[model samples]
Target chain A: MNKKIKDEDIKVILNSMDFDIPSEIDAKVNEMIYSENLPAGFFKKLLRTSNPFIKWVPAFASILLLITLGLIQLNRNAPERKPLSEIKIEYELKDKNIKIIWVKKENFLLRRLKK
Target chain B: MTLPLFFAGEREITEKYSNKEVIISFNKFFIPEKKALYNFILKSVSFSEDSNDIYQNTALRAFKYFRKFDTSKRFKPWVFSIALNEIRKYFKNKIQSSDIHSIENSYEQIPDTQNRELAEAVYSAAYSLKNTEREIFFLFYDSGFNISEISEITGKTQGNIKVILSNARKRVKSFLGSKK
Candidate 1:
């Protein structure tokens, strides 16, 4: 099947395909190039300017600082008081502010009987 | 040698810069190749608007990546690779955004112009081919790249390119012949 269409026929078809680029198209391209307001020294400027360290570094440092502060606060606020079973506490309201009164059961009964 | 000299010395530095220097130096370094690139892209895409967009994208991409370019190599193929990428991107986007029904409906309303009618005929002929065959035939024959270069671009062996082109030519001939 391929043998029937000679080489010349393919050449003719290829030649028939026109590649006419119109002038207005070129004008449009030229207009775009002219209109582009690229930054001064776009390439040299890009290569010369180093990226900011603070963008990632500051963010990382702040996160570490927050975690450290949280850990310190957690340790400081932890309870260190002795267990309530060892020394019993009774509350007495004398003058609006409450006071802690330590009580032993035997001593309190003897004093109450004499009174 | 002379071309390199034109690109190597003071002209090279001036053209390489992107400020007013590029616009001024374009009259020399860029203008001569502009028409050829435009024509190449136009034929490659076969649509005025798409061709123009591809052309602009190719130029901008080429300019941006120019620093990485091997100056010793020919610039035409390098720029062409970019243009081909842009065209591929356009089609991929069209497929992504447009539904199949819309495409079929749009085809029914194809405008009546001589060039458009001829374009429709050629496109229908090309569409009947297998994907690989159509790609190789259009890229090599219609877009005017030789078989060796098409092999390089498509990463196919020369023998494979020949087989694809042979099969594609037969399909296109039959498709066109059936119409008559």
Candidate 2:
């Protein structure tokens, strides 16, 4: 006679086959962990202000902030460009198509036309 | 069993020295896996004493390196990998000594007759597998780890795990088939 087994049967059979865990296993592990006063973790070291990493973090952040602020300051330092309608640009026609263009505020003379 | 999203939103908790919170999260993450972890160690190492030592070492090492555990991945495979390494290290030492342990064979007999019989049958079927195949089999049925997770734990390719598991399954089926 051919007999077949299913996964469910295996699962049930296997799960039921577990060994009795020694009771002291938990206590021993607990004692071991507690002895360390709990692990502070690897990344936890960075949280310490005493760590070298903390010193550089502020410096990096300040550098980034300064760069952003400097960019803004540099932009501010640039003369505000007047809109086309705001500033007057004057052009005097010397000939049919030849003209001199200059900002109205500045006096510039077109002395000689290049040959 | 799956872990709670321990590092969600409050990553600083892990990166800080908050002992109480860290302890709670660690316990929450590790407690449910305890029995399974112990059983795996027990099945892998001979002698209850040595198994206990391996078990303690695996747990202690895991705790000491808890921060190194990636929060995004499954904890089962990570812990399983550590347990496997510990078992290997034990065996390597045993091999040098000439005579120490041959992969744990002690079983505490169960009281109930029907369950005991089933346990014996399952044990026989499981033991019929090759060493690596047997490890995969236990990880599959006992811990419910999928192929990918078992691959990660065992450091075998997923394709290799599938082939090994399939062959192991055929053997187990044949073992069960023969019993009829």
Candidate 3:
């Protein structure tokens, strides 16, 4: 019991199918191939001479490291500038120089604010 | 460069690679076939610009990898396999880049409007197919690659290629039907 479609149907469909080959593309193709050959040849030689780990692994590792370093630097630098405590300042008359204080308590306020 | 004694056909590869005549001959072998290979890839991907890129890259890949290729076997399929690999790579890149060229359209669809409207429409429709199905479709029917040859080119089992082709035929017919 075969259920294949009609041959005529296939012919109709296939006939309607058309392929376009742009003439301008030929020159471009030639250029692309020549250009590709240079890189491929270079890479092939590089692969042959270079250590496998150095060839494939280090590139990825370097990228991962850059990303890791970027994130670490981001974390370390961004959050630390906004400190939690209100200002606590102290001033004293020492060596004939006046120093003032500013802090949490009201009595500590003069110590905190008497700058 | 470390010259290895073990590249079994290193002599042939090196000889042909260095000799301008052999390289030219190898290129000549591809010149006539270029249009056909171009058509095979173009019909599936159906981008005029990308087709050219694929064709050129395929040729370069074929040239570079010709050494690992079996010298005794017919060169067309071997070289085409290399081209096909490059085309897949091209599509992978296209997909990665978020390009609008779809791997989902039918093989028969082409660009809209112009003297080549119908032709382009059909071509674009074919271009719309999934990458796998389109490849098998074009390889088997358009490029006249047989099942085994396509399997060899694609690294799929012949049975798997047959199934893909079956699905492609169905999808193409339906796509054409909706257009009508």
Candidate 4:
């Protein structure tokens, strides 16, 4: 037969048990708190550690910023290209009556030249 | 005669004002609970030296993170949660390099007392329990944390907490009855 134990009995027993903590714990904890040497915040601690990725972040950011600024500067200093205007070429028909041809200057000059 | 100030009045006024308030609040809540907290740690760890270390570590951690503590909540559960984490960390570190045989041998010796045979029995029974079971039992009975609060502390659901508490109580009771 399983005998049931009362919760009161357990509570009384546990409550009566003594734990001896050094009296100086309170003072020591208080001193630690007031000593201005508490562990730094999470972010501060993360920054403080010598992790390779974290260590390189600033340098990487600076390099990226420099590259971006250099790109912007180069873009600003670059010479602007002029847009091409339409040029009409008129060919004359004289003897055969079919010699006249009209061609765009860009197409005639660049495309025909390349071809 | 006016007393000399140790720091610049402006620096002192800003920093000390805030720090003093935090210090006062911490002391007010923690000082009174220190004994209970220590007792709980001692019971949880089942060793004086380890308990002392865990206790100090908990206090330091609680103080360090006290600013994050919500004033709307009860302080005891929050502090107990920190203590619980410290104990977990301690056990995790000890699991690999620790002597299992030594721990088994150490359980045989809980200091004897003439007047509190029941207390001794309960303690011995408690010490025999698995760490998680003992911790749950202590949090429930000795520390007065409710099921939900224990769930929050242990990061287990209320149902799980209840099951663990029931099992722990049954084991302790059975152990005690066997001893009788």
Candidate 5:
């Protein structure tokens, strides 16, 4: 018995027809975007990362952030140990409040940067 | 500004159009539909060179009328309707015929593949159908659109689309059976 294929089965076969788009659709789209000033989709624009400097910017920014953190760490660790006489610990007695403060050496951050 | 430009292709996009958020949104919404839509158009035009023109016109028209588009409704069928209009406009002067012979010359030889014979036969059956039938058939099958969606795109009732699609499939099935 030759059974006729069901419509659903025929539809499934049509799915695999796999026609080649047969045209440079994206190229045409890009041409419209750039030449006609039509907005190219950001996702598409994101994929075209051709600029060398732009590509390196992320690495450069990360390196800069790392260096800044390193300098801050160096400044924090650069404090010279001082004898009890040289270190000034001041306590301010005010109305109902007592605040203890450690005085920072003048130009301490500047000296750390010089290192 | 310096940081923004550093992020690859931003400079190009910004340099092209200022206040492009609307266009960007339009492209984002429309691009996903492009390949399926283009394939439908390509088949509709019988893979003619003007298929590109129809495609471009469709996009441009979509962009042009983008403001009037209801934000709540779906974009796919709306954009498809615009494309359908472009296809119809292209065929206004000449007949919108699904003549198998005209399509055969332009259809090119289907590449040798596992199911090439069956694919060719399926396409042959499709070719012999009326223009409207083939359009709905491809949208239903090739483009994977459902009956109501086809109705939305074609402005036909769901029942009407189902009947057309049913008839189209039966004819294709008959043709395929005759092949065996």
Candidate 6:
């Protein structure tokens, strides 16, 4: 038998039907959410605590770690400097003699010019 | 010097608040709907204990994936999708165990109506439906979901939902008429 049921009639029937909502459901769902949302491991627990100072600890540690790594890399890549005492300054007498001769020649030329 | 162990403890304490926040928000949004959700599950499963278990499982699943939930979209259809999946899983497990008779026994235990013949007829007709049809029927009529919302929850095309809803209403009407 084909009977036409109006959408309103169906809604009325469905709404009129009564079902008990288990009283413990709210508590149970809350408990489930609590248990499921718990921080999974040590790091997760550390990141989500309520204390203000405590909450910044991960951020601090991360920044400190980055600084430490940067310093290590900077130290590794830096050129080694020689100690002042170990640095040798050599005077090549040959070049010194050449310079002296040039000066002597200039002086002689000046003297000749004056004469 | 700050000891490494002390620093680790501080990090643990700090990290816990985000999880706490998620739980707080979940409680705020979900607690208000718990009764409605429980009633829906109860009607869908037609057994208190099964409904309770499914409800708990659904809540747990929802919590586990709560971060993935989009804030812009409505929470109702998303949560209902999870509950519907749990229902399917429950029945699949039951059938695999060859415990189909338990379903029949649970149906027999549906509470008797309080002298409302029409209500009783409607109730029986709703339960007589196949699980998918029953879900669509309830989602549309009782839960106030529109066709698109039903499609989103069930992953069915709108056309398929319309067809199923049409068939479900036909069955209900015929059953009610015969009962009269």
lDDT of 6 by residue, B1-180 (tens): 444333445454345437678778777767766666766776677653677889888888777666557667888888899988998888888889997567543544444555355555666788888888999998898888999999999999999999999999889888977876
In model 3, the Cα lDDT at residue B42 comes to 66
RMSD, each candidate, Å? Answer: 13.7, 9.6, 16.6, 9.7, 17.4, 10.6
Q: Which segments of model 4 are wrong by more than 4 Å?
A: A1-4, A39-115, B1-17, B100-115
TM-score versus the correct structure, for each prediction: 0.54, 0.62, 0.58, 0.64, 0.60, 0.63
Q: Candidate 1: lDDT of B111?
A: 45
Spell out the clash pairs found in candidate 5.
none
* Reference-based lDDT, residue A26, model 5: 60
Using TM-score as the measure, the top candidate is 4
Model 5 iRMS: 10.8
Error of 6 at B102 (Å): 2.3
Q: Candidate 6: deviation at residue B71, Å? A: 0.6
Off by over 4 Å in 1: A1-11, A17-19, A22-24, A34-115, B1-36, B43-48, B99-123, B130-132
- Per residue, candidate 1 scores C-alpha lDDT tens digits across A26-115 of 676666667764446666643332223324667989999999999998888667785553456789898988888886664667779999
The candidate 2 chain B region of ten consecutive residues with least summed lDDT is B1-10
Q: After TM-score superposition, what is the CA distance of residue A95 in candidate 4 from its true location, in Å?
A: 27
Q: Specify the CAPRI tier of model 3.
A: incorrect
Best by DockQ: 2
lDDT of each: 0.61, 0.71, 0.64, 0.73, 0.72, 0.72
State how far residue B46 of model 1 sits from its true place (Å).
4.6
Q: Model 3 TM-score?
A: 0.58
Which sections of candidate 5 miss by over 4 Å? A1-3, A19-24, A34-115, B1-19, B96-101
Indicate whether candidate 4 or candidate 6 has the larger lDDT: 4
RMSD of 1: 13.7
